[model samples]
Target: MKLLIYDHDGQLVELEDVSAKTLMLGIRDAGLNLTAQCGGCASCGTCHVYVDNAWQAKLKPPSELEDAMLDVVEERRESSRLSCQIELTKDLDGLTVTLAPGSAFE
Candidate 1:
């Protein structure tokens, strides 16, 4: 399984064989500076990312709680998702996401 993360500078970080980890964990492991203030508990929108439209359906639907958190993020888009809420799996191979501007590393 693999994932492509488009960072704030538009650099794409490729992750391979990253299974059983949340998207937030994958990003953190990649050395990007996304803020997961509440860890992977989805309590904060600090890990927000915009799912590439082509890969949106491949991810699990966000829960009500996640939707609420997303609402507070001014950069939220129709494709907005909390990385912490997304679990990496073989089915998510090739998943691509762009870091939402609001959640970009400072």
Candidate 2:
């Protein structure tokens, strides 16, 4: 599967091996920045990302924990989501999202 991630600079970075794991795990395992300090715990907003508008509805609604966590994201948008909460499924094979401002490797 392929995941197109737009960086803070609006550059496109493609991740090709999205296995059956959370989007954060796939992206991080690919050696990308995706901070994700909370490690899929949905407690930190560090994994913030914005789902491309066209692909927003294709995802399941966020859980309560994620919803609460999102409230803390400084750059949260209408389509903002925590990558740790999204499962990579065949249905989302070509998912596209942009890493929010605070999501950095360092």
Best by TM-score: 2
Worst 10 residues of 1 by lDDT: 13-22
lDDT of 2 by residue, 16-102 (tens): 766748889877887777889978899889999999999999999999989999999877789999999999989998899988888
lDDT scores in order: 0.87, 0.88
In model 1, which runs have C-alpha deviations exceeding 4 angstroms? none
Q: Ten residues in a row with the worst lDDT in model 2?
A: 14-23
Candidate 2 stretches with Cα past 4 Å from truth are none
Question: What's model 2's TM-score?
Answer: 0.93
TM-score of each: 0.92, 0.93
